[model samples]
Target: MQQTILEARHIQKQFHDPVTVQVLTDITFSVNKGEFVSVIGKSGCGKSTLLYILSTMDTDYTGELLIDQELMTGQSDAQLAHIRNEKIGFVFQFHYLLNEFTVLRNVMLPGLKLARYSEQEVEHRALERLKMLGIEHLATKEAYRISGGEKQRVAIARALINDPHIIMGDEPTGNLDTKNSEHVFEIFHELAEVHNQTLLIVTHDQGFAERSGRIIEMEDGRIIRH
Candidate 1:
């Protein structure tokens, strides 16, 4: 059997203002190593909310979150930050690139933040990732000089610079055109199949979700299918 890379047990999330609202129900799931999984649901169904919790960014929930056999829930902010920097990669709907920085520098930022490697080593790794993603030619170009698709590819390279075990994306292709979206998906597919990287993507596009190896469908703050 494949090893479980991440697990969520009985996760419950709520919010309170004048009234209490449950954003996520008892969410329990496991993602096997090298698996490409997608979480899909309508807006307000808690897919993104659950993704945030799984990313270890939202600590207000009640549950046990285990990633690579380590219990992450209830960890202190510093500890969680360490985990995020070392083990998890994230891509959002927007490319989130630094427009003023060169593509190479943007990709090197995360590695520098991790402080695990020297500046030269980080730059080397970042350039290698850009090459792998077919964006090395744009490495010296500023973010604003690249096309939208190229910018997204640069973002992916940045996410991979630290070689995180799990890559999580929230609507990563939501801003791309159909062709560009397909290109992004193909890159993710290759990463999972060839590099054995685990991926957890929350997307609204049916074609994108369907092509992923597994789909977890949520509705009304609860998982309805997997």
Candidate 2:
């Protein structure tokens, strides 16, 4: 049986304004190791909110979350941060690369957070990932110098540098052209199959969602039954 990499139980989240706004109600799901899952929804749905909660970034909700046989709700703030940094990789719609940093440096930035690897080791690993993704030639280039697709590939490399068991992406290909989007989606599939990384993507594109092993539809802050 495949190991469960991440799971959410009875997850509930609400936001407050002049009136209470409920975003997710009893949302729950689990991701097995190396599985590729995609959640699709319209804008204003709780897809992003669910991703944040499941990824262990936001803890304002109430419920149980487990990662690698560990209970996430009981973890201290520092412990949660370490878990996110070490075990979960995130890619956002915006590339989020530092303008002044080169592609290689951008990829290696996350490695600095973990102390075990030597600088040379970090460089070697980053280089290998870049080459594997066919982005090695752009390593020394500034962030702005790369195309939208290349920037997304570099973002994926950054995510992989942490050796994360679960990779989360929010509209990772939204801003790209059709061809670029297809390529980026292919890379995400590669991440799941080749590297055995559990992948979750939040996307408005049904095409991308359909490509995943599982598709979750979200609407009005809840997962829609298909």
Best by TM-score: 1
Residue pairs clashing in model 1 are none
Evaluate model 1: give its lDDT: 0.94
- Which parts of model 1 have CA positions greater than 4 angstroms off? none
Candidate 1 per-residue C-alpha lDDT over 1-226 given as tens digits, one digit per residue, 9 for 90 to 100? 7889899999999989869999899999999999999999999999999989999999999989999989998799999999998999999999999999999999999899999999999999998999899889998998999999998899899889899879999999999999999999999999999999999999999999999999999999999998
In terms of lDDT, the best-performing candidate is 1
Error of model 1, residue 146, in angstroms: 0.7
Local distance difference test, per candidate?
Answer: 0.94, 0.89
Clashing pairs in 2: none
Q: Identify the runs in model 2 with alpha carbons over 4 angstroms from their true place.
A: none
lDDT of 2 at 225: 52
